[model samples]
Target chain A: MTRTVPTSPPMRRSTVADQIRELILSRGLRPGDALPTESVLCETLGVSRSSVREAVRTLATLDIVEVRHGHGTFVGQMSLDPMVQALVFRGVLSPGDNLRALREVVEVRMALDLAVAEKVVAAAAGETHPELRALVDEMLTHADHGETFLDADRHFHTMLLESIDNQLAGQLVGAFWDIHTAVLPRLGLALPEDLRQTSKAHGDMLAAAEGGDVAAYREAVIKHYEPLQRALDHAN
Target chain B: MTRTVPTSPPMRRSTVADQIRELILSRGLRPGDALPTESVLCETLGVSRSSVREAVRTLATLDIVEVRHGHGTFVGQMSLDPMVQALVFRGVLSPGDNLRALREVVEVRMALDLAVAEKVVAAAAGETHPELRALVDEMLTHADHGETFLDADRHFHTMLLESIDNQLAGQLVGAFWDIHTAVLPRLGLALPEDLRQTSKAHGDMLAAAEGGDVAAYREAVIKHYEPLQRALDHAN
Candidate 1:
C-alpha cells in the first residue's frame, strides 16, 4: 500500500518578499546562515531575478535578510533597527507638535522600566553590577564637567535591563532611547539646568537595585525621567 | 560688510536613503504629503534616477515613503508595521525554540498592560465602555460554544489603550498581539482547556477598571495571562 503525505498551503500568500520570508522560515535558517544564491532562489520560488532581488532588498530593509558585498545572502541579525527608523521618522515628521511624540516615547519608556522594576531588583539580588556603578560614576563625572554623558547614559539604560531575559524589552528600551536622542535636537529645546541631578538619578537607581529595594528602584526610575519631563514642559 | 552663514553638515551621511529622509525632514513634509518626482528628486539630491528610486524603495519599506502605481509618491503612515514584520519574522525563524520567543512576546504584552493598569482604570472611571463590555460578552459567548474569539480579543486589547494618549504604545501592543497570533499556531501546541476561565478574565479586567480599583485591575491582568503561562510551563 502506498501512503500519502499531506501538505498545508502557504501561511501568508501575499508578496514575493513574504514568499522569501517563508522560504527562510521553512528552511529553519538561523541568523548568519547562508541562503541559496539569487538565481537558485529564483528557480526555487519560480520568480524572476529582479523580483527576487526586490524581495531581497525589501527584506534587507527589515533586517530580515543580510546581503554581503563580497559574500552572499544570509539570515540577518533580526534587530529592532526598523522600529527605530520608523519611530525616528514619526518623531521627525511631527515638527510642530513634537512634544506630544516625545512625551509618548518617554511615557512608554517609563512604563517599561517601571514594569520591570521588581524583576530587575530581584535579579540584582546578591549580584553587584560593577559595570552599572561604573556607568553611573562616568555619568556623574561628565555632569561635573557640565558635558553631556550620552554614551554613558545610553549604556546605563541598556545595562539596567541586562539582567532581564527579555530581548524584545531591552531592544525596545534602546530603540526609544535612540528616538529620544534623535528627535530632541530637532525641537531646539534648551537643556535642563541640573544635569547633576539627572546624573545622580542613575546612581540612585543602581543603589536601589543593588539593595533589592523595588520601591526605591521605581522611585529612582520616575526621578530619572522627571528632568526630561520638566524640560518638555518648559519647551511648551 | 558681507557676512557668511554657517551650514551644519548632514546628520547621517551614509546612504541615499538617509539623504532622502533628510530631504523629507528639511522640507517638513507630513504624512500623505506628495514627494518630488523621481527625476526632480535625483536632480535635487545630485544622484542618478536609479539611485533615487532605490532610496525611495528603501524608504517605502520602512514606511517613510509611499508609492502609488500611477499617482506620485507621498509620505507613508509611519506606522509600526515594520516592527510587526520584523517581530513576526523573528518569531517564525526560531521554530525549534519558538517557546522562548512566544514567552518574550507574552511578557512584554503583560508588562505594557500592567504598566498602564492605573491609567486605564482612571480613564474608564467616568466612561462607560459598552464596546469593551460587548467584547467581553462576545468572548464568553465564543468560549461557551468552544470557538475561538480572536477578533474580539484583538479589539478588546486595542480598545484598552484607546483612552491613553500614546500612539506608540498602542501600536506596540497591537504589533506584539499580531506576533503572538501569527506564531502561536506554528508551535503545534494544544489550546488550554480553560477557555471560559480565560475569557472570563477579560470581563474581570473590565469590571476592575469600571470599579476604579487599580490593584484589582492589576490582578486581573495577571490572571488574564495565567493560563498562557501555565500552558507554556506544561509545554516545557
Candidate 2:
C-alpha cells in the first residue's frame, strides 16, 4: 500500500511558529539571547515538544533563530539568505522562454543602483570614500584581465549600500545581485567585450561620488549598465 | 543519553533537489507541468527514494515545486511568499527600541513606489486607470469615515504596480508592502490623524497619473508618504 503524504504549500501557516515568534518579540530577546528551553516553551504554549521543536526549526530556516548543540536556541541575525534562495529558485524554475524574468532582475537592480548612487553622492558631499575608490582602482587593474572582477564590483556596490545605512534596502539589493550573478552564468551569459569601458564607468561613478553630483552619478550609473543593457538586448 | 537530532532547516540543502530542479529546467517544464513518478525520479537521478522525497520536500518548501496528494509533483508558480516571510520575521524579531528596521522598509517602499508611479504615468499617457480612480474615490468617501481606508490604499498601490507589466517589481513592492502592514500593527502605529489630508494626497496622485505628469506623480508620492514619515519620526 502506497501511503501518500499531502503536497506541502509554498508557505505553510504555522501557529506554533507565530507563538514562538511572539514570545521572542514580547520578551525582547536580542539576536544572541537564548530562547526558552523546549520543555519551558512546550509548557508555556501548551503545545507538544515536537510542535515547539518544529517551530524553532522553521524559525531557524527563516534565519530568525539559531539552534546550537547543547547550548540551546538563540535569535539569529537577520539575513537575505531566504530571499536569495527564493530568487535562485525563481530563476532556475522559470520555463525556458524569453529572458524576461532575468531581465526583470536586471531592471530592478538598475533602479536600486540608481537610488544608491544618488544617496551615496548626497551623503559623501565632495568627500571621497576611500573604500569605494580602492575598489574602483582594483577594478581598473583587473579590467582587461579576462576575469570577472566580480569581487571588487560586488564590494563597491555593497559598500555603497552599507553607506546608506538602510539594512532592508541593502538586503533587497544584495538578493537581486546574488540572483543576477548566479543566473547569468547558468544562462551562458558573460561580461561585455569592452572591459575598459566597464572600468571607466565605475571611475565616472567614483568621480560623481566625490563631487557630490547626483546628476553625474545618475549618468554614470546608466553608463555602467550600458554593457549589461547591451548584453540583455543581444540575449533578447 | 541525549542523542540530538540536528534541528532540520526550514530549507535544507539537497543535491537531489538541485538535480530535480535542473531536470525541470532542462526538460523545459512550465508551471503546473507534472513531473515523472517517484520511481522514475529515483531511477533517473540514481538517488535513494528517501533522498528524492527529502529533496522534493525541500523544493516544495521553497515554493519551487508543488506536490499533489495523489497526482504526482508539478512545477510551482514563482512567488514572493518566501521573501515576504523573511521580511515579516525581520520585523517581528527586531530588538525593540529602534524603528530603524521598520524605517528602512519604508524607504525601500518609497523608492519602489516612485519607480512604479513613474512607470504608470509613462504607460497610461494621459489615461486614467479606473481601478486606481475608484480606489482614490473610495479614499475620498472614507475620508471622514473614521476608518483607515487601508484596503483602498493597498489596492491603489497594488493596481499601479500591476499596470507596469513587471511581475518581479510588483512582487517586490507587494512584499515590502506586506512587511510594512504586518509590522505597523505590531508596533501600534496608526495612520496620520488628519484624514482629509490623507485623501487629498491620494487625489493629487490620481490627478497626476491621469494627467501623465511624472513630476507631479513624484511629488504626490512623496506627499502621500509624509504621514508615515511623521509617524516614524515621532516613533524615533
Q: All models, DockQ values?
A: 0.37, 0.26
* TM-scores for all predictions: 0.91, 0.88
Q: What TM-score, to 2 decimals, does candidate 1 have?
A: 0.91
Residue pairs of candidate 2 with colliding backbone atoms: none
Candidate 2: C-alpha lDDT = 0.75
List clash counts for every candidate, in order.
0, 0
Summing lDDT over every window of 10 consecutive residues in candidate 2 chain A, give the lowest-scoring window.
Answer: A1-10
Badly placed stretches (over 4 Å) of model 2 are A1-11, A37-50, A67-72, B1-12, B37-54, B67-72
Model 1 lDDT, full chain set: 0.80
For candidate 2, give fnat to 2 decimals. Answer: 0.30
Highest-scoring model, TM-score: 1
Output the worst ten-in-a-row residue range by lDDT, candidate 1 chain B.
B1-10
Docking class of 2: acceptable
